[model samples]
Target: MTNAIEFIHVKKEYQEQDVIEDLNLSIRKGELFVLVGESGSGKTTTLKMINRLEKLTDGEIFVNGKDSQAVSDRKLRKDIGYVLQQIALFPTMTVAQNISVIPEMKKMPKSEIKKLTYELLSKVGLKPEDYWKRMPNELSGGEQQRIGILRAVIAQPSIILMDEPFSALDPLSRKQLQDLVLNIHEKFDTTIVFVTHDMNEALKLGDRIAIMSKGKVLQVATPEQIAQNPANDFVRDFFKASLVKNIYDVYIGRVGMVQGYITEKPNQKSMLVDSQETMRAVFKILSKYEYVAVQEGKEILGYLSRQQVISYLSEHEKD
Candidate 1:
């Protein structure tokens, strides 16, 4: 099957200098793809090139199997939704007006747009009746961001480009919005290309993550795959925070979820811990061995090490 979006030898240059060089990637249909990198790394440039917001200096970009540049700008943009970190909700417009912008631009009927406004607002947990007539100033930062995303997708675009949409919000609000996006993606099955420098966010939200640096892609991998096998030191350092956070999850959530997991075929010479054992118990076992294998019967779930536990706590403990 053809990819939802493809970049073939894509390159972007500014002031006779290349910002993106010989980049090639394919994002799967109906999956959330995340781009993670530091500033000046061309993640945003790559995104903008997809919808022709920025013309490619060289090479080709295909959206839904059609050359992106071959399509009319206005028409192509209408088929690609955009959400940003600083969500630009028109302060003069009411919530309904904001969400209805895309649909209205598509020349949807007023009646249909009205129905969709309510339906989508409700999906994001905002009651339409309470928020329908409220201006952007009246909504909280998080609420405004939600409305921005709602506006982007109300036209039912085939793809949504989210550029650090939740980066500006507080942690709690950011987390809420992340869950909402995940739900929205699952329900709509739209191809989403999310851009962020936050590794934690990338791991949590992406179906697969692409790490970029200096206009080149370092690795493209799933969360677990990347965690277990980083392509290089750069990729490993980028994901270190998320890896530590997962260790904390084990510390806090290790007990209850182990039910029904069984350990068998215990190699008499090997150090092992049953799945039912707590991380604290694993810590004690690790004192005698470099690491203790976590097994459920013949299946090896993973292993635990005292060094990993210490490393996890070192970051989490308040100074």
Candidate 2:
């Protein structure tokens, strides 16, 4: 796939101190890409460079294959959508007004913009009649974020930059918005560069994730790839912090719940096991069969091979 964004030996400095060093990365078009790391890891700085929220001290930055510096700031930012942790809505404007900001700025017909705004509001489960004229201050944190997200994509920009957008919300709201983001990505087929310090969010949302640290990117891979094969000590330990209490938790994190897994029916001879079964019980079943069907209650989620279980265990045995 072609790149939506590319960084060529990029570097950034703040007050004579290097904030990002020799950073090189590519985000593919139409993919939900994640940049994740602890604070001060340069993930946010790297994201800002893409939209010129932060300028590059050295090296080339390209958006859609053209040098970003060549594009005028107004044109560049207008084409790229941005969402922030602070939920930066026009506090003075109503929900409909906020969502229609970009469309209006582009001189779209007032009627069309209103229609699109209401449609999007309903798509996210926000009833138009109920929320259309409500001020930002009247909404809850999650509700405000829903509007912030809607505003970002109002212009149908091909690329959206989300910097810790959902970090400030409660767990339930965070989850709801995460689903909303996934749905929006699927519906719009837009490229998203989401920044987060949360590993679980990264694993759950990204097609591929880049792990950054100390102004450098340490590894970039699919969630499953990173789980099974961490690039180095930093990568391994960083992910390790997010793993559950024991081997069972670790196994579930890998197979059942972290990334989406498809379900397939088992054969007549296949043994069945509960996801909550102890590792010893699973080991016994695995020893006799090449693979076993894993289930939760009556639902058969998917199959896990003996080798797959062993491989996952060996990798996390140290934890």
lDDT of the candidates, in the order given = 0.81, 0.86
Candidate 2 lDDT: 0.86
Residue 2 lDDT in candidate 1: 51
Task: RMSD for all candidates, in order, please.
Answer: 8.9, 7.4
C-alpha positional error of residue 188 in candidate 2 after TM-score superposition, expressed in Å = 0.8
Native-to-model Cα distance after best TM-score fit, residue 167 in candidate 2, in Å: 1.1
Q: Which candidate number would show the highest lDDT if scored against the true structure?
A: 2
Q: Where is model 1 more than 4 Å wrong at Cα?
A: 241-312, 315-319
Predicted candidate 1 versus true structure: per-residue lDDT over 1-319, tens digit per residue = 5599999999999999999999999999998999999889999999989888889999999999899989899878878999999998988989998888878878899999998888999998999889999999998999999999999888888999998898778665786799888998998899999999888788889999999999999999998898889999988876775445434334312432333222343343347666545455566666677655666767677655556556545644422
Question: Which 10-residue window in model 1 sums to the lowest lDDT?
Answer: 252-261
Q: What lDDT score is found at residue 196 in candidate 2?
A: 94
Candidate 2 per-residue C-alpha lDDT over 1-319 given as tens digits, one digit per residue, 9 for 90 to 100: 9999999999999999999999989899999999999999999999999999899999999898889999999988878999999988888999999998888899999988988998999998899999999999999999999999999997899999999998887655887799899999999999999999988889989999999999999999999999999999999888877553345433332454643443555454567777655555677777788777777779878877677677666765756
TM-scores for candidates 1 onward, in order = 0.78, 0.78
